[model samples]
Target: MKEFVWAVSIICILLVFGVVLLKYLSENKKYKNSSYGKQSQKSFWKIISNQGARGEYRTSQIIDKAPFKNKMLFNCYIPNRSGDKTEIDMIMLCQKGIYVIENKNYSGWIFGNEKSKNWCETLKGKKYFFYNPIKQNRTTV
Candidate 1:
């Protein structure tokens, strides 16, 4: 009878743990779907910095360490005919032609094709839309 009682206690404990885990996951999912998750992080630096900026910063850091650092420009802006400014992430002036480079920093499971106008990503049941960088960059290039 004592052994049976212990088994019952163990099962109850495991079931409680499982329930708690499920609740945590569900709460997390809800949080992600909420505006709190959708809202961009509010910080003094966050205002000036972002994922794309961070990615470009990382790229610059790498280029700064490279052997050919003198041939690249970072965050170069060009004015379009429409009086709008187009920001190029990185530009490599080569003998052949000026190469326009675009960078994107992303996490989670990315789901999109090369031709898709919009790319989608799923992170813990949340979905995000990002414009196709290739297509977007082609206009400036």
Candidate 2:
């Protein structure tokens, strides 16, 4: 019967969703238990799903392993000239001075000059344009 088929389909869909949710939760727990994850202070889903987050997390991991005593901050927001908040990916405080890091996680042939407002990335015969990191850092600092 049509009603019986519909009921079975719905049950199957729910079962699949439950399984996926369980798997995601399990993975997230494992990530949270790791040292990098703890330092990142981000959920597994967040780091894995967002490219920028993944870049920032990886940068944090590298900074943690460095042979120096430094304080690092992530996802910091500071007010700009326009009174709007600009998010800085990472910041490092050390004996040298304060360093602001703008991470760009792009996989391709990147082309841009420091003065350019935007940059280009060519991957798989496709081009992607993004704001220049140099100008972005200038604005943040």
Candidate 3:
């Protein structure tokens, strides 16, 4: 009878420990998922604000304009400094050589010259300066 009692106590202790461990693991997973969800939402908004969809359309236009062999590919990736990082917009692997292109879409009255450090966009005569996409694309290429 005493041996049976000891076995029952051991089993009860093990059950309690298992329950605590399971709770901890579940809480950790919930926390991780919430943080990841927040990050993904932020990234999605950034993409929309940056007009990434318009850029893709512009890239398609550039691909159509370029003359290359039928087999040459467009939108091929070029490796950047990082192993997983790539500066991919439009690429054509042709008999000439590899060509890298970056596309930008701006929907306002462009109000700056080439000599200007910052280019301004005038929408209804309200001017706002934006980052120079030419410099950015040069670096991206």
Instruction: Write down the TM-score of every candidate.
Output: 0.55, 0.72, 0.43
Better of 1 and 2 by lDDT: 2
**Candidate that scores best on TM-score:** 2
- Model 3 Cα lDDT, one tens digit per residue, 1-141: 999999999999999999988986775454334322222333423433557544654354445556665222434456555554555555556687876555556667886665566788888868888756566455554
Candidate 3, residue 56: Cα displacement in angstroms equals 2.1
Candidate 3, lDDT over the whole model: 0.56
Q: Give the distance in Å from residue 51's predicted Cα in candidate 3 to where it truly belongs.
A: 3.8
Model 3 bad stretches (over 4 Å): 1-50, 65-67, 70-86, 113-116
Window of ten residues with lowest summed lDDT in model 1: 35-44
> Residue-wise lDDT of candidate 1 within 1-141, one digit each (tens)?
999999999999999999988986775564344332333243324422578755655565565555643466666689866778898778866566777888888889988887999898888899999988888787664
If ranked by lDDT, best first, what sequence of candidates would result?
A: 2, 1, 3
How accurate locally is residue 96 in candidate 1, as Cα lDDT from 0 to 100? 62
> Residue 91 of candidate 3: its Cα lDDT?
56
Our model 1 lands, by Cα RMSD against the true structure, at 12.0
- Give Cα-based local distance difference scores for all models: 0.68, 0.85, 0.56
Superposition error at 79 for model 3 (Å): 5.6
Q: Give the CA lDDT, 0 to 100, for residue 72 in model 2.
A: 80
